[model samples]
Target: MDDTLREDQKLTVRAVLAREGRGFAEEIGLGRTNNPASLFGLLVTAVLVAPRGESSGPARAAHEVTNRWHTPADLAAASAQDVAKELGAAVEGVDRGDGDDSASDTAATLVALASAVSETWGGDLRGLREKAGHDPARERELLTALPGVDDGVVDVYFREVQPLWDEVAPFAGTRALRAAAALGLGESAEDLARYGNRPEKIGRLAGALARIDVEGSHDEVRRTAG
Candidate 1:
């Protein structure tokens, strides 16, 4: 009974990740960072610099962070100044439309993320997944404990990271959630699994659902399914 129940849940969230979550993730370049730890770093950095930071900033920061620190311990041990220097180097290559120096908070957040992950989960993101298993609530709790992570980053992570944590449902931000409702999938995580049983299928569905919100054509999904 439990196994069946879990599979059902997996199907719902995976569908959203694959279907509705991809384009949204890619628009912000969040999907390109494959390493789970790097993904976390990118999410943290993006949130820190939001409302002013460059759209490309997260990708640069993630790449620099993953490159500079080979291990969780390495990242955790880095001084704030070291983090700032690496992030500064990353920003130098990007066009920050406004030509603003917006990396300080991002640097601080990544440093906090590194310290938290290293201390709490031994720096192995996979271990955190293993600990959470397929339970979204537990994942939420653990992610919440991370020093610099917030609700927005958490939602984005759960949406774009289907490949790493396939069990988590894609959280279609405010816009996409409305589309999910239009498609008859309730706003809750479990309601999403009913859309598809396979993880890959679910991921595609997640991308598809998110596309609706983006395109402002909820009818497109209905037409496609037909």
Candidate 2:
């Protein structure tokens, strides 16, 4: 990948990040923070956000459950019915316009996600990292094995977790890559990282790119870039 970014690329990176840079975890106060607490927040947020038609509903729902259960063990201990009640309350009257069915589905997914983490990694993602030998591909494979984790959810998790997991640095998923291409930042993770210009900036940039797609701000970002 090229080391230097064009003027448009630079502007796009700067503007998009300035406006919508924070990842879902960060917006919910997790902030790309690495610790078990933050990791649980990121993982659960990924699961919640992956299936929602719009992010705000899941984002609100994440706040509700994450605050209620600080750790995966706490969540895993709760009955799916109880989780559904909380998620339903949080998701109700949200912008996603989803009904009770959506909330119930999300509740089931959250319970399964927490149970998998609690049982497999003892509520600590570091165990998963160790099990994967810190290999990004292996980490991805292991992550996919977790309940409610599919390719899309993995993308959401990877974008946020890259800041914590060293081997996964400079990672960008399909959503981020699409946004990057729209902004002239190239289509590959490596290409996006070059535009980021620093190790720490890579995750943030990838996150911002993903948000452009999610929030439908690509054209606005492009205009800002120009």
Best by lDDT: 2
Candidate 2, residue 221: Cα displacement in angstroms equals 1.7
Off by over 4 Å in 2: 1-3, 89-99
Give the runs in model 1 whose Cα sits over 4 Å from its true position: 1-54, 88-102, 178-226
Per-residue alpha-carbon lDDT of model 1 for 1-226, expressed as tens digits?
A: 1244454344544444534443334444443355655555445544443322223455455656666776667777887666666666445443323333455555666677887787887776666767988687887777877876666556555655665566664444444466677666667444554555554344445545655655666555445444
Error of 1 at 149 (Å): 1.2
**Model 2 agreement with the true structure over 144-189: per-residue lDDT tens digits:** 9988898888877887787678688778888888888877778898
For residue 202, model 1's alpha carbon misses the true position, in angstroms, by 5.2
Local distance difference test scores for all models? 0.56, 0.76
Best-performing candidate as measured by TM-score: 2
Among all windows of 10 consecutive residues in model 2, the one with the lowest summed lDDT is: 90-99
lDDT of 2 at 151: 82
Clashes of 2: 0
